[model samples]
Target: MIRLLLVVAALFGATGVMAQDFPNKSITVVVPVPPGGVVDLAGRLAAEALAGELKSSVVVDNKAGASANIGATYVAQAKPDGYTLLASYSLYHEVNPLLFNNLKWRPESFVPIGRVVVTPSVVVVHPSLPVHSLKEFVDYVKKNPGAVSFASQGTGSVAHLGSELLKQDTGIEMVHVPYKGSGPAMQDLVAGRVQFFITAPPAVMGYVQQGRLRALAIAGSERHPMLPEVPTSVEQGFPNFQLNPWVGLFAPADTPDAVVRKLAAALEKGLTQPKAIESAKAAGASVSFQSPQELAKTVAQGRAYWAALVKAANIKIE
Candidate 1:
């Protein structure tokens, strides 16, 4: 019994030492989407901020595939030693498990480090759409029914689900066009191949400013700083119409509490830095840091609400 106690004490001591020396080497923040999108931008920003705070090398690895399942599984299977972390969001953390059958990771697979940023989404229409606001868009879609088509980053993405929620709320029918990535979807939307898209400001604000696309409405309670002229969906009377994609940091579950606290503290402090805040805002997101417990609760509540939406929408992925 004494020998067993000694072994346990040594194990705890080692963990303490490891946590104290946490991230002594390079750290990788795995992003589950392709490069060039706002999420990737957020991940890169997080890496830079963390590198400053931790005083070590922090890099991003884009393992984009399978609707964020690839990178999520990779992170889930990574060593719970705080070196291999995930720069992920609602889709990977909360929604994918509901959408993917035989999903390898669960909500518990990740230890929530902290939320990095939250970017409010907006609705943009092609120049030819003839809709200038959310109400007009809804009315036009209802009038056209299956004739009008909408673009999504992918079938299971927040864009897709948010569109579905819009359809359910307003009883509008539009054909769904899912793309391989947000880049392709934006490309087609800009080309008028798809009539509409719902995405972040960084992705669509340039088009809106250039008059290439019409900004219908920001989908949250508050209007975006980048597009202050655009009114929110709530102002248009559809208070339920909202989709803000938030990115958060996570490590594999079973990561030591000491390491988790250290990383979370760095993230919290990093977010307060003027550089981090400005960079995030420049990328069309705001630096909104949530503690692990707060993030965990948000994830759980989001999962529940989204699961019901999925069921009601009868959304399926082949």
Candidate 2:
């Protein structure tokens, strides 16, 4: 019994030492989407901030494909030694499994380190569209019926699901146009190919300011500070129209609790920095942090909500 106790003490000591020296080398943050989008920008910003906090090199790896399954799978299968991490939104973890059938990794494949930021979706219309407020847009869509089209980042993206919820709520029948990415979709919306687009603020706020597009409503619980003139969907009479996409940091499941805590602490510290906060705001995301336990609960609640949404919308992807 004494020998067994000595062995256990030695094991704990070794683990403690490893945790103290955690992330002694460079770390890789995997982004499940292409560079330049909101998620990608958030990942890069997070990498920069985390590098400063850890005093180690942090690189962002863009492995975009298969609706974020590719990069998520890469991180899920990576070594759980605090070296490889995932920087993605809740959609990849909470919504994708409900939408796709071929995903190799499940939500349980990751251990939440911390939540980074939450960005509200904005509803913008092409300049040519003959509508202004959310009420006008809804009325226009109802009148035009199949004459209007809405663009989304992809078939099963948050943008798509949000629009689906809008259609269901307002009883509109606009056609759905799926784009490879938000950039192209916004381009098409600007060119007047699509009538309406629901996307992140960073993607359309500049255009709205330039008068290329008109802001209708923000699909959030409250109005966004950046777009103070635009009211929220709730204020516009759609009380249930809140869709905020949140990005968080994660490591492969089975990562040591000590390592996870260290990383989470670094993330919380980094995200609170003025530079990080400004950078995230420039990307149209508010810097927000949540502990691992809080993030886990958030993910659980989001999974339940999104699962029912997907089922209700009949959103399916092979």
Candidate 3:
């Protein structure tokens, strides 16, 4: 009986050590949005880059629904191994908790790997609208009241909250028009179906450049790199109004320190690659890599900031 017990213990110990050997097989990346979107594109780009660095297959799995809560919750409940990772935007970690009261996992449940880029949302209006700048836009909304309808990516999405933040700051009433995604929202904005849309740069940059939509302001403390001529909401008289929706990588909490460090380093290295830089730029994002500690601090601050806004505005998911 003593000999049998010793053999069983040895087998269990061996199993534990084998489990620690991460990436022995393909790594699965859970992309919490549908295909062809900016989030999906970023995940694919990162996965391909990381796979090349690690010399292993990195598969991107699209798990779309519930504004990313479905995929995020899956990662939160997954085992703390480096094999499974979540490729999500800032909305998943920082903004959703304020909108989604039924979310099963909080921001604290995941471990930060690092960030990819900070994508700034542009405050845009249809070309037909009389407003040219953010101040003029606010004045127009104030004069028109509920006549100005603002299109958003979806209910409780960053675009939605961004518009809400503007409302809170300017004290203007604009009817909320929620679309299935940013693509559709921008479509309506270009067609003048909606007078205004607070959307990400990638979705609206083309139209703004083509004169189909007019970019009134960038939603951040300073001007966006791509739209340097445009002023920020803060500069347009709404001081302290800044919203930057970022994309980040995360592993389940309690992942090995070595694995986390390895992934973070790889991500940092990947950002400097020409392809990564080009892809980010094409998506209207600026590449800014952070270490795990720095990422954690940013995540914490973002959560608190968005949560405070949600509370003050009495915002809720619909």
Candidate 4:
């Protein structure tokens, strides 16, 4: 019994040492998407905040391709130390599992560090839509039915899922036009190739301001600072239409609890800094730090939510 206790103590002691010496070296944050996108921006901001908080050189490595499997697999197989981390978002974590038949990694692949930033999706329409409000837009869509088309970043993305939710709630019919990325989607939206869109404030704000697009309401509960005049769907009488994409940090599975807590502390405090807040706000992302446990809860809720959504939407990758 004494020898057993000694062995347990030794194991915990080693874990303690590891947590204490935690980020002794430069940390690498792997962004699954290419540079210059919303996820990439959020990842870079998170890396900057961590560097300031932990006093370490944190670098962002972009490993883009294959629906984020490449970068996710890289971090999933990385050493279970605090140094290697993944900056991932909602679609990658929640929807990918429901969309893809074969994934390289599962939810157990990483331990939740915390949620970093949340980018709100807004419902915007082309200036030619003749809809000044969400109700008017809904009415028009109901009248036109399948004639009205809405654009999404891809199948099984937040836009797609959110749009599906909107369909279920409003009972409106619109053709889904999936794009490779938001850039092309936004361009086509501005050109009137598509009549409606629901995306983050960054890509749509400029167009709305320029009169190229008309924003009806934010999909979430709160209005974005960039587009303060636009109300939320909840306020506009669509309480069910809330879909905000968030980015989270994670380490490989089996990471020590102490280490995860320490990193979560840094992440929470770093997100509160004015620089971090300003930087995130500038990128149309808001810093809302979630503790490790809180993030895990959110992940679970998102999983069930997306699963039901996929089943209802009849979403298929192929």
Candidate 5:
């Protein structure tokens, strides 16, 4: 018993030493999407904020492609030291694993640090579509079947899952049209190439505000502060249908717990800065932070939720 206690104490002492000597150099933040997009913008904001808080430079690298698997797999396989972190969505860690049969990394390959934001997807339609509300959209889709088309940034993306959830809830049928990214999907939606899309508010805010697209409903339980006029899907009759394409930080699996805690603390401090708050506001996000454990729970719940959805809806990548 004495030897066992000694071993445990020695282990803790080593962990403490690791935490004390951590972050001796700059850290790299991997954004799994292309630059200039909403995810990239959020990552840059957090990186700048963390740099100040950690007293070390935090560099954001954009490695976008392959439904975000390229960057995700890169981070998952990186050294488990917390120096290389990923700023990505729930889809990459949760949904994609269920959608793709040959995902290189398992869902448990990364340790969730904490959530930075929860930006929900809004269900928007072309102005020409005869839908002024979620109910009307559902009714119209039912009547039109495959004639009504909805665009997504890519397969297995949150935008795709959001529409799939909508279809499961309302029993509506709409053809799926996948695009390279949200920009292209939004362009097609605006030009009438597709009638509806489940997209983040910032990606389509300009078109929605300019009257090119009509926002039928949001997937969040509460209306976004940026667009309070828009109602949530739950308010429109579907209950418990909340979907947020949130972006959060994660470290490679087996990363030192102390370093993960340190990053989480830095994230907490970063989210409180005035500059970070302004960035969140501009990005249509409510500045928020969570502890590493809280984030892990969120990830777990998200994985279970998406897995169930995929099973029930029979979603296939091909």
Candidate 6:
């Protein structure tokens, strides 16, 4: 029994030393989307900020495909050491598994480190659309039923899901147009090929300000500071119609608790820096930090929420 006790103590001591000496080399953060998108921007910003806090080199790797499964799967299968991490949006954790059938990695395959930023989706209509508000847009869609269409980044993306949720809530029937990426979707929307799109502010804010797309209402609990003039979906008569997209950091499951905590501390500190905050704001996002425990709860809630949304809306990917 004494030998067993001594062995356990030695193991614990080794773990402590490993945690103290964690991340001695450069760390790689994987973003499961193409560059120039919101997720990529967030990952690069976090990596740049975290490098300073951790006193180690940090780089971003974009693995854009299969609705983030490709990159997430890579990270999920990576070593549990504090070197390889995932910086992705909520869809991979909350919606993809529920929407796809043959996923190599499950949501539980990764452990949450913390949230980097949370931004609400904005409802933007092409300048040619004959609507000025959410109520008017709904009425217009109802009147013109199949004539109206909306664009989404991809079939199972948050933008797609958000539009699906809106259709269910408002009983509107509009054609769903899926694009390869947000850039293409935004281009089509601007060209008036699609009537409306509900996407992140950073994706559409410049267009809205430039008089290309008209802002109607934000799909969040409250209005964003960047578009204070626009009202929220709640204020527009759709209570509880908020869909805030969030970016978070994660490591493969079974990572050492001490190492996870250390990384989380660096992340929280790095994300709160003025430069980081400014970068997020410029991207139409807010720097929102949560502890590892809090992030786990958020992920759980998101999974439950999206599962129900997908079921009720009968949302599927083809």
**Against the true structure, whose TM-score is highest?**
4
Q: Candidate 1: how many backbone clashes?
A: 0
lDDT of 1 by residue, 1-318 (tens): 999999999999999999998889999999998887667877887788788899999989999988788998999999999999998887768888877889999989998998899978988899998877888888988888897889997877878988999999999998999998788999999899999788888788889989999998898899899999999999999988878778889999999999999989888887788888888888888999899989888888888988999899988886
Cα error of candidate 2 at position 11, Å: 3.5
Model 6: per-residue Cα lDDT over 10-33, one tens digit each: 999988999999878999999998
Model 3, which residues run further than 4 Å from truth?
Answer: 1-21, 225-228
Of the candidates shown, which would achieve the greatest lDDT relative to the real structure? Answer: 4
lDDT of 5 by residue, 1-318 (tens): 999999999999988887888778989999988887667877887788789888997899999888788999999999998789998877887888887778888768888787887677788999898789988888887888888888997878777888888888888888889998777998899999999888778877878788988998888788877678999988998886678767888899999888888889988888888988888778777666878899889888888988898898788888
Better of 2 and 4 by lDDT: 4
**By TM-score, how accurate is candidate 1?**
0.93
lDDT tens digits by residue: candidate 2, 144-172: 88998999888778778888888888889
lDDT for each of the candidates?
0.88, 0.87, 0.82, 0.89, 0.84, 0.88
Off by over 4 Å in 5: 1-11
Alpha-carbon TM-score of each model against the true structure: 0.93, 0.93, 0.88, 0.97, 0.93, 0.95
**lDDT for model 3:** 0.82
Clashing pairs in 6: none
Clashes in predicted model 3: 0
How far out, in Å, is residue 114 in model 6? 0.6
Kindly provide the TM-score of model 2 when superposed on the true structure, using C-alpha atoms.
0.93
lDDT of 6: 0.88
Winner of 4 and 5 under lDDT: 4
- lDDT by residue (57-132, candidate 3, tens digit) is 8999999888888999999999887888888798778888777777888888889888878788888898888888
Q: How well does candidate 6 score on lDDT at residue 96? A: 88
Q: State the displacement of the C-alpha of residue 250, model 4, in Å, after optimal TM-score superposition.
A: 0.7
Candidate 2, superposed: residue stretches over 4 Å from native = 1-8
